[model samples]
Target: MAIQTIIVGTGRHIPAVIVPNSAFMHHQFHGPDHQPIDKPNEEILEQFEAITGIHERRYAPDDLLTSDMAFLAAEDALASSGIDRESLDGLIVAHNFGNVRPNAHRSDLVPSLAARVKARLGIRNPGAVAFDLVFGCPGWLQGVIQTDCMIRAGAARRVLVMGADTLSRVSDPHDRDSLIYADGAGAVILEGREGEPGEGILAHAARSDTFEHSTMLLMGPSYRDSAFLEAFFLKMEGRKLYRYALHHVAGAVKDCLDKAGVDLRTVAKVLIHQANLKMDEAILEALCRLAGLEGAPPGLMPMTISWLGNSSVATIPTMLDLILKGDLEGHAIRPGDTVVFASVGAGMNINAVVYRFPRS
Candidate 1:
């Protein structure tokens, strides 16, 4: 038997607040130059929806911080897997902005979100190391990859990885891209188990292009001039970012598939990051072309961006939780299925993992 790193359980926290496109109607939109946009709010929203396919998103309640959401998701994952919290060998939390309190411009990350989560879970084992990962949107997948390595190296047997982000608190309300921001959390438990070949994680790949694309997404002063000159908000070069993802993200996915020696046609599902509908579609097209497929088979990709918006790191894991629990209609992952998890974000980072469900 071979030791394989397999996901045992998953969970997600979808915030209750629903923010629709109309919610931005009264706000004045602006360009990166800090100049007011000439377009009307309705026209801008219509175009935004057509391009991003996000009609609404979720926001964490004012009282709940990013760590709080991660805790909730961790509880759910532990319960789902029925795994003892004390048995976890490590806890990894992934996020870009640390715990930013409501109406606060500064990030508070002194204790580390992973440490806070480990404490909240009441896991008293000092042997269970806790740490945070800040790898942009692909942070969560990166955590999973790290856990797999740890387990394979005999340094750990069980671990909990989470991705939680409160993008609403950091996004610029004055910028149209603010519509793409949301808040949520998701968690997964991975365990090393004796299993047969072709089980669990098969292969993975990652890349970063900081030389030319580092500023594709960065923090800057609010697009609309505010009295608080010291405050900064998340900003992005939307068109350039889109083009970059379309050009490179698919290549990363292909690299992972090749490493695993798996054919694209055999893939059952592609759990890609919920960045944008059109952009994801283009990436899929690019992947199919690179693999010599005419097009992506229908239902090959399951997405939650329309309602959940872009929850940064939480997107893929949350989508996985939904699918596993039968919450996502028209999607299911059965035994022995091959799936791909891929993401791209602020680091100008991209990663892909190929996994095969245990045959048992």
Candidate 2:
């Protein structure tokens, strides 16, 4: 029997605090020298909203850590799947930074985050492995890809793939790049099931641009301000990132669909990484154009960035849970539908997975 990786359940954990764009109004902005550089707040916001389409986002309290968020999300996913944790075969965690504090730029690097979350879940199976995957923004999706291979290889029957990040802790609150991030976690339970046509992960494609790997996404050295210290803050070449996604990400999505022998019209939804709203819209337009789609259909590409901002690997899965569970008002998923998951970031890697929704 061919093993198919089917998503049995999904869950997410978002911080309690809701930060509107206005919250940054009076907050001090700083330059590389770490000195305060005050800009017209309203003008900054106008440009921000116009480009990113994000008005608000959630933030983990200074005390909250990446593993903490992952544990919360993992619990929800385990509960939703109704799967016994001890009986699980694998637990794979995806993340960039482990856990950081509000004033701390360095993430705790002692014990692996997967170990911490697995222990928190109280799973006791020597045979059930727990580990971490560091694959930049495509982290969680890469975890899923590995889980699929494991299931097919008979190394696991069930696996938990979770992506969590606390970019809020590492971000320089005053940086525009920091404005693009938030803290959150999303988890999916993948079970080895009988291969049912169009009812599991159908096809996928991945690519890495190694030449552009000069820390296009990077954290800087310690800052004079504790808030800015360490390699804590993230900086990026927005224009380059945008160009790569537009030129490559859409093509990757199209490739995955083609590999599945499906048409763009057959995909029920296109969930690309929630990096920027404007950039996402641009990618979708090019994607549709590549697929020969006429004016990309509405609601086919669900977005959570306007409210959630970007949580790195957590963005896609969290949005998937929100939409599938009907928590996301404008988007939806029905049984038997196929959804395309795609992302590009950090490692300059791009990947797309074609997933088929299952009917109960």
Candidate 3:
């Protein structure tokens, strides 16, 4: 029997602070008179807002850590699912960085997070499993695929999938790349749902081009030191990355759809990694041409990328939260609709999964 995993609930937590592009434009360039630059902050903000459809982004205060955001997002996901913590079978946290230095092992993190939730929510029966997957932007998609497999194999009944990152702390404020990255967390509750075939995770595919690994990477102990942070903070060959993402992601999506015996046209929505507005637009255009769609999936376009920039792994679920909140106007998804979740992260990794919304 194929395992049927349904997304029972989804939630996201973004920091209260709204950082606009103007914040960056003004801070970067100064006027000849040694005063503030005369660049039009409004124009910059408006161009970004129009391109990525992102008004503003959220960020944690100076003191808060990534785990804090993860905890909040998890609590909300569980609550929204209406399932008590006691009923959960396991927890999987997908992150690139840890709050504590040297980072605790996965075995240690599971119990720690579980204990935190138990003490806070008053549930103690469910066993907790925590592990860190440092796959950069593709981490969350990997978590979802892993959870689906566990549920299908009867290894777990319910799983918590979390994608949280605080890139700001490790980022170099002076770097253009660092300025684009923000911190956030998003989570989903995956549970068994009996349904017809092809209704859940129909297919998933991933491919990595390790040869391009050096294009984007963090050097040294992979730990943040002052000097390391200053030199190695979020460096990227933007042109190469943009090209690689389009090629690999497109291939991955087609492969997944082919494996599932579904055509691209059948896919109702494409929830791609919100890396960049221009890149996403290009990918969508290519996909539409290949699938022979009259145009992009009617309003099912990419979510906000300009404001949020590249949130690493948190992009998917963060966009999912927006979709749930009715923010994705004109492209409202419905039951039985087939959606594709695709992402390309550092390490030149690309992943794509096909799923069908259950008729509730």
Candidate 4:
């Protein structure tokens, strides 16, 4: 019997602080003497907003940690889905940083978050187990695969898939890449159930070009050479990464669709990782060409990068939340639609999944 994982609910939580791009210019570009830089926050915000279509982004309060954001999103998802917390069988979080002590195993953050959720919701079940995956932007996709497998194996029936990160905390304020990173969380409830053929998670494909792993990296405090941390904070060979992601993600998307026996023409929309506006456009073009979808009508390309910037693993679900909020209301996506979820992240990892919306 083939097991199916259906998206029962989705939610996202952005922080209360709406940090406009101008805020970055004001704090980061100032001279050592506290003098204003030539470019004001308004000008920077205008440029970024125009290019990325993001006006502002929310940031976690100073005292709040990434796990808090994760719980926030989980609460929203459970409420919106009307799923009782007590019924949840497992929790899977994709996070790059945790509240745990340095050098401690990263998986420890899972139980900590699980405890908070259980306490807040007053749901105590021994089945509640938490685990963390640190795969940068591809973390959430990896979580989806793991959760799907677990549900299929009967290890879990209801799985909470969460992607949360506080990249800004580890970022270099002086770097543009750091300025673009923000903090937030997004989540979805994947329940074990069978969907009609060509629905739910039809197929998934992943690939990694290990030689390009260094293209994006984060060195932790445990490293003896603290200097590496200076370079590790969201550093990227932008051009190199853009080229690689376009080529690889495009291929992965097509491969997944092919394996699912679906044609590109049947794809209603492509929900890609909101890495950047330029990279997105390039990947869109490449996917069209590879799928022989040229001259096809334009598809939905909702982006959260302008405001949320690069949220690592949280980008996909956050964008999905934005979609649910009518961000692409005029777009052609509808029930029974075939969509592609694709991402390429820091590990030089590429993953793509094909799903069909349930018919209303």
Candidate 5:
């Protein structure tokens, strides 16, 4: 039997505060020049919805911090896995921004979010190391990959990995891109299990292209001139980032599938990052083309962006939790199913993983 890192439980915490596109109608939109956009608000939002497929998104209440969301999701995972908190060998948390106060203009990260979550989970094992990962939007999947390596290397038997972010707290109200951000938390427990070949994690791949595209997704002052000039909000070179993802993200997914020696037709699902509907569609088409297919099979990809918006690192894991819990209609992963997870984000980074559900 081969030791494989397998997902034993999953959970997510989606905030109850819903922010719809109409909420932005009264706000003045600005371009990169800090000048007013010429388009009318209705036309702008209509096009935004058509492109991004985000009609609404959730926001954490002002009372909850990023660590709070992570802790909630972690508790859910622990309950689902029925794993003892003290038995966890490692705890990893992923996020781009630290704890950002809903009413303040600053972010905090003095004590790592993982440490805070460890305390909240009541995991008193000093040997159960806690740390954080900051790999952009691919952070959660990257955390999963790292946990796999640790288990495979005999450094850990069970690990808890989580991705949570409150992007709404850091978004610029004046920028159109701000409408694309949301907040949520998702987590999964991975444990080393002895299983036959072709189970659990099979292969993974990652890439970083910072030399030329480092600024594609970054932080800058508010798009509105002279407004909170001292504070920075999440910013992006929209077209550049879109083009970069289209050109590279598909290749990364294809590389992982090839390394796993799995054919595209055998894949049950491709859970790519939910950045934009159109961008993800194009990446799937490109991945199929790389495999000598004309296009992706119908229903091969499941998306939640239309309703959940983009929650950065939390998107994929949250989606996974929903599907596994029968909350996401029309999707299910059965035993022995092959699934591929991929994401692209800040750091100009990209990663893909091939996994097979364990056959009990």
Candidate 6:
């Protein structure tokens, strides 16, 4: 008998502060002269929205930490899951910069964010394993993959997968991209179950494109591209990363569909990372072309960037929780629907998962 993993509970937590694109309009950024530079205008705001499709995002208060946010989301998931905390076999967290404290990256690597979450949850299983995964934006999905494997191997009956980040903490308030980053956390409970065929994560594709060449998409504190101020914040080669996802990632997704033995046209919904609205649209078009569809599937992809923006690793899981909770308009997952999840992020990592949403 083959075992499969099913999502028993899902949760998300967003900071209280809702920041709009207009909020950054009147703000000043670092200039070449080390002077304040404000690129504010009606046209700039309009263009920013047009290019990114991010209208607003949330920012945690100064007091809240990344682990704090993840704890809250995990609490909600455990509460709703009807699964006792003692039964959780492991905790897997996906994060990049760990916790960021205003302008500085504060990582708790010694203890690991997963262990912190495990203690916070008050789980009784001492032998339970917990760890962190740093795979950029695709991290949460990667965590999902790892947990599913553990369950199938009879290593654990249940696992908690979480993604959380406080991008605003390290974001360069003066940088134009500061508007795209925000804070949030998401969590889900995966339990091993004997399920019908075409259920659970049917197939997956994971790959890394960077080896000898530096992608220069995500970087640490350093001198930014010809900027006067130090580039301690995350930077991206937006155009190149976008093209990589569209070309290489789309092909990977096609292979994932082939591996799953499912036709692309039958995917009920595409649950993609809420990175950029425009890039998501382009990815969808590529999927359509790969599937040989005359047109992209209508209402097949739901978006959160317009409102939630990008929260690093939290994007996909948080977006999934939103749809599951019916927080997103015109998006709902009925029982026994097929879903395809894909994400591409730093490390030049790309992954796609074909899942049969549980019948509940």
TM-score of each: 0.98, 0.95, 0.84, 0.85, 0.98, 0.93
User: Global lDDT of each model?
Assistant: 0.94, 0.86, 0.72, 0.73, 0.92, 0.82
Any residue pairs clashing in model 3, and if so which?
none
* lDDT tens digits by residue: candidate 1, 1-360: 889999998999999999999999999998978899999899999999999899999999999999999999999999999978999999999999999998888899989999999999889999999999999999999999999999999999999999999999998889889899999999999999988868899998999999999998988888887555445788899999999999899999999999999999999999999999999999999999999999999999998999999999999999999998999999999989999999999879999999998876
Question: What digit string (tens of lDDT, one per residue) describes model 4 on residues 164-255?
Answer: 88776666455444556777889998888765565688888887777746545544321223344433444566657767876677878888
Alpha-carbon deviation at 200 in model 3, angstroms: 1.2
Candidate 2 lDDT (Cα, whole model)? 0.86
Cα displacement (Å) at residue 79, model 2: 1.0
Residue 134, model 1: Cα distance from true site in angstroms: 0.2
For candidate 5, the lDDT comes to 0.92
How many clashes show up in model 5? 0
**True-vs-predicted CA distance for residue 61, candidate 2, Å:** 1.7
Q: Is candidate 3 or 4 superior in TM-score?
A: 4
Query: Weakest 10 consecutive residues, lDDT, candidate 1?
Result: 223-232
- Clash totals, every prediction: 0, 2, 0, 1, 0, 0
TM-score between model 4 and native: 0.85
How many Å off is the CA of 325 in candidate 6?
1.6
Where does model 2 exceed 4 Å of error?
30-39, 221-230
Candidate 1, RMSD to the unseen true structure = 0.9
Q: Could you say which candidate leads in lDDT? A: 1
- TM-score: the better of candidates 2 and 5: 5
Residues 241-289, model 5: lDDT tens digits = 9999999998999989999999999999999889999999999999999
Model 5, runs deviating above 4 Å:
none
lDDT of 2 by residue, 1-360 (tens): 567789987999988989999988876666667666667878888799889999999999867789999999999898888978888898888999887766654778559898899999998898879999988899999999889888888899999999999887777666666788888999999998886566799988888887856567877742336453556577777877888788888888888899988888888899888999999999999988999877788789998999999999999889988887889997789988889999998878889999888787
